[model samples]
Target: MPINCKKQTLPTIEKEQIDLLARLSNASGVSGDEAEVRKIIREEITPFADSVETDVMGNLIAQKNAKGKCALHVLIAAHMDEVGFMLVDKDSEGIYRFSLIGGIDERSLAGKQVLIGKDHLPGVIGACPVHLSTKEERECILKLESLRIDAGPGCTDLQLGSYAVFATRFQAFGPSLIGKALDNRLGVATLIELLKHCPEHIHLTAAFTVQEEIGARGAAAVAYNHKPDLAFILDSTPAMDQPSYDNAENTQYRTRLGFGPAIYAMDSNTLYDHRMVEFLKTTATENGIPYQIRQPGGGGTDAGAVHLSQDGIPTATISVPGRYAHTAVMIARKSDWENTLRLLTASLDSVSQDIFKNER
Candidate 1:
């Protein structure tokens, strides 16, 4: 007998998820450098998850027993990598030259705190002083080369190969969260929350993917191997509620803070499965769970890689709305976090053919 969405028990996210998110946000994970973050995930997931494993590319794959039901493959993915800096060179005087691992606004690079090496050595990115710049120089865009990292007095002590991650730690701001790496750390934390109450018969696979900041490389491999009947990417979508950007015009979607989870209809990577999109939105509405759909054309998630794998799997993405993404201080709404857990758990519990039928 298939589980009915109406009859499914909704699971609530606890304070543990928030704590984990804060820890992950503070941890160092700059694209290829995710060993420490992976270790943290492994520890948390080892007990509750049925079979914990890692893919060739360092993707943490955790499996749960599924009563052996065919077409019951449900893969939920969240990238563990975050945008940060990587060493490019070192000057004769020992100042470090670096490049960004993920997309970062050049304007935000000036005077930002960062972590370098296994010792978590502190450093600050320095840009030319505004007073020193000429009118033409000030008008010019801040190029990546213009930024330099200051590891403080004894610069020779640091090596050229060390990595640099955003140093801003997580903070609770009003009803929203402000911290670094909330972009995907929030997504990872959501998956962790789901693991605690996940039903034994659900037959689900959750992956803490890597290198999503560079590309959707980690999710691509996992999807090809599992080839699940359905897949969902839990991630963070950038919010345009700030003053600089026009939330309605340039932005394709506008999901406010505390407004439940953002359900993406389309992104650069993949067109969401129509049935899955409708089911999730309708399910949330019927269940009184707050939710919103991404506009016609908008940002993408790991679902892009998962849906296009092997024979082409159906996929959808649920995101937590975040402000100042890619920057050190990212923010997520409290309600958005709670609502994502409710939505995903409900979808897992509600699995009838009628709900998935193309005709209905």
Candidate 2:
């Protein structure tokens, strides 16, 4: 049977959208402290959503109801949190010891500029000077114990338990976007665009989740509450597409820049529902949108928790490939971000219960 395609014209990624992405990337929203990011999304989406509410767990769930009866309920989620640090103890007048909030790489911490708390107090991660360290000590990895956040001697407003993040500002290169927290902020911006131009035939539930970098905590609460007929998890996946040290073919490149959106099949926590996977692939193909299959491997997204809710809900994950995730900064291509938006828009426009009728 031939599938009839409406083939709606795709929307272009304009400056306004890029500006939104920049704001989202620049804002500090460490895991469990996503109020800033949540506020931005809420203001942008409130006028478009049929109803909006934040859950007890801090997931911002926005609903856009379909007009007709028997419409399939669809949920699309993008987490709002990023990995960062938490000040645990004060060491001196302006020095503090901090603990990692998520899976941030300790190797990237030395001498990095950081912004602490809501005030954005400037600080630097200080480490032992290389010139003074013994050769044997220099050979070892720098542990968290050896690091201190120095905010300067006059810093009196600093408080323990405050959150801190890299002070990297968003930048637009020739064809790339570089910024902190691009991992999920790219997804956040994508979801915001979808909300503004949602289709009219199906119920749309948009979840801007939190605490995903620590664990998919907010997603779990969202899934249990909404229980949409199906779901799509939007996130940014790490792209190990850099050249191999041996100069050999980089067969293990998880995803490549400019290739297109990466659709997941399997990961550490979830085996994506095949029907949803095929649906996305078919939608992309029919719409002439480019896409790539994310290499099946470890690392999971909110789909890890979403697919396991309430006797199980069918779910799939689509990501924009990014380089250097969970670090101080990340790089992603604008084309890939645009194409990801295109594929999701096309899918939402065409989704139907026929997806579930197909065998699992």
Candidate 3:
């Protein structure tokens, strides 16, 4: 029998794109301690950025001069932090106790592995075994109060107040991407690409924001400092497309993989600028790109703070869908990320001087 191998042609957005995301998603940047993630972004943008400034709040605000007359001074933002834990105390046996840094579901945290501090000390979030739990205990989900992070019995590198993050390594399989912190890492990588391909028609102000996991504080600072004509926030949103526990049709599938980027009209924060909304969807339609209207509901992005910055600014939000966000592992479709990039690039490229001329 002859040995057989098949030639494979990957997606147009291949290794280069995936590589950047891998580095970003794998880096640890929990809320306040964003230096690790910022370093990568700073180096990546140095060549393309006209000016880069690290704000007092740690927001990496970069400007890229337009190749031609600026049609719109557009502020584009992608936060650089993820939900994680901060070491609060070390237990008697060398195990540690930590408090969550951002919004994370404790119910699913037990047994998940983690990395603590700059050393990336490996650890696991341990929970009570089923054999030791009563029927009532098993009926309820695990809470933070009952958990401890075990770095092993003799570990000593970390100290109290150090940050910790999930140790999920980024992986690409077929069209699926799995990793930790894809929520905003995808956004961060996308923003870097946008800056490299900065649109000639707009004065691009890119904010690789910090502390978005802690109420979008970094975004708030950028908005006040940049004061652009309009803004677009790039981030990731949850794709609750999984099958419902009941096994019935999952009607609440807010976004499903392969559908395309989700356009935000309204979230828990600011209602996105209406004309900006029309501009985005129209661009997607004209370009024959698929897009989804994220149902008006709870949840928000950097735009929440940016829109309120400096009297007010017109804003729109877009997100690549990731399932199981704010958890140890997240899943996103490669196609969705590609489409998101396509939509954002096209929208930025064609943004006109009159885009904000229309009334609110």
Candidate 4:
């Protein structure tokens, strides 16, 4: 049966939200080093939440308790970490050998600018110049061992384990947003906005998780700690919507920009709980919010970890399709982001204990 209820007044994406996204996208919170991003989130959500706590694993959990007794507990998570590099060994005055902190493509590293340490000291991933390389050497793919971070000749401030990220500054390009770390920062911003406008009917637990780029370490810990009735993981999925070399329909394009939120059916990790999936789809349809079923395939989100925690917690993922995720820069449409927020808000507004009554 279709839900018959008053129309939900969805929250609009505003300059404040965009500004917060820019700050999050620009911040360097690679995998295990998410303090800066956590700090920003702590400040933003403090006033709006009923209680806020940072757990042992650096996951920031903020709760908004429902006024009535026995309200459904809903957990929403967005990772606060991004793919980056960590300095390992200093080879020269300003040259350092760094290892990848997450699943960054090695092919994209050479000649890219990076920011190192808490000071964000500028550096570049240096490689042999094309002019200097032999044809045979150029034919082979560049390896991490062959690359070095060139901070500067006089720079000696970098530590052995300092983290670094791409130096891509946030920018609004027409209707799209381009920046580094947009993968999860977009989700982070969305979660913050959701917290601000969270409905009072359910107990909402918003988790800003860390170390997700490496694995779902923070999310696993968060799940065990909070153990909500169900979970929603907000993330950014890759949009392989680019034209193919032969332009033969490009059917494998996982997700696309401007298509609105991509709701997960299945992925590499968890088969999304059918009840949650149906609930989201029904909410989007009834609310007239645009959405796409994310091409079920490789890739996973925080839900991968959350669903397996406790006896079982139903989980589903909703993502904003982005192009070139885990690279120096990624692009996602502003309208898609707005619709994602709308869908999530409407879903939260409509969710109740009855959703669980349906057989999974």
Q: All candidates' lDDT scores?
A: 0.82, 0.93, 0.87, 0.91
Q: Deviation in angstroms for 93 in model 4?
A: 0.4
User: What's model 4's TM-score?
Assistant: 0.97
The segments of candidate 3 whose C-alpha lies over 4 angstroms from its true place after superposition are: 1-12, 68-71
Report the lDDT tens digits of candidate 1 across residue range 152-248. 7676678777888878988876788889999899899989877756755567789999889888889999998887778889999877755444444
Better of 2 and 3 by TM-score: 2
Could you give candidate 4's per-residue lDDT for residues 1-360 as a string of tens digits?
112333456767788999999999999899889999999999999999999999999999999988789989999999999999999999999999999988988999998999998889999998887899899998898999999999999997788999999999999889999999999999999999989878788899999998888789999999998889999999999999989898789999999888899999999998998888889989899888989999999999998999999998999999999999999989999999999998988888888878889788
Ranking by lDDT: 2, 4, 3, 1
* Residue-by-residue lDDT tens digits, candidate 3, 1-360: 001211121123679989999999999999999999999999999998899989999999899776666456889999999999998987767688889888888886898899989878899988887899999988888878779999888887678898999999999988899999998999999888888877565688999999998899999989998888889999999889888788999888777888999999899997988899999998888777789988788899999998988989989999998899998889999989988887887787677757668777
Clashing pairs in 4: none
Runs with alpha carbons beyond 4 Å of true place in candidate 2: 1-8
lDDT of 2 by residue, 1-360 (tens): 012325556777889999999999989999999999999999999999999999999999999888788888999999999999999999989999999998977899998999999988899998887789999998898999879999999999888999999999999899999999999999999999998888888889999999999889999999999989999999999899988899999999889999999999999999999999999999999899999999999899999999999889999999999999999989999999999999998898888999889689
Candidate 3: which pairs clash?
none
Ordered list by TM-score, greatest first: 2, 4, 3, 1
How many clashing residue pairs, candidate 1? Answer: 0
Predict model 3's lDDT versus the native.
Answer: 0.87
For model 4, give the 10-residue run with minimal summed lDDT.
1-10
Give the higher-TM-score candidate: 1 or 4: 4
Q: Please give the RMSD to the true structure for each candidate, in Å.
A: 2.7, 2.3, 6.1, 2.3
**Strongest candidate by lDDT:** 2
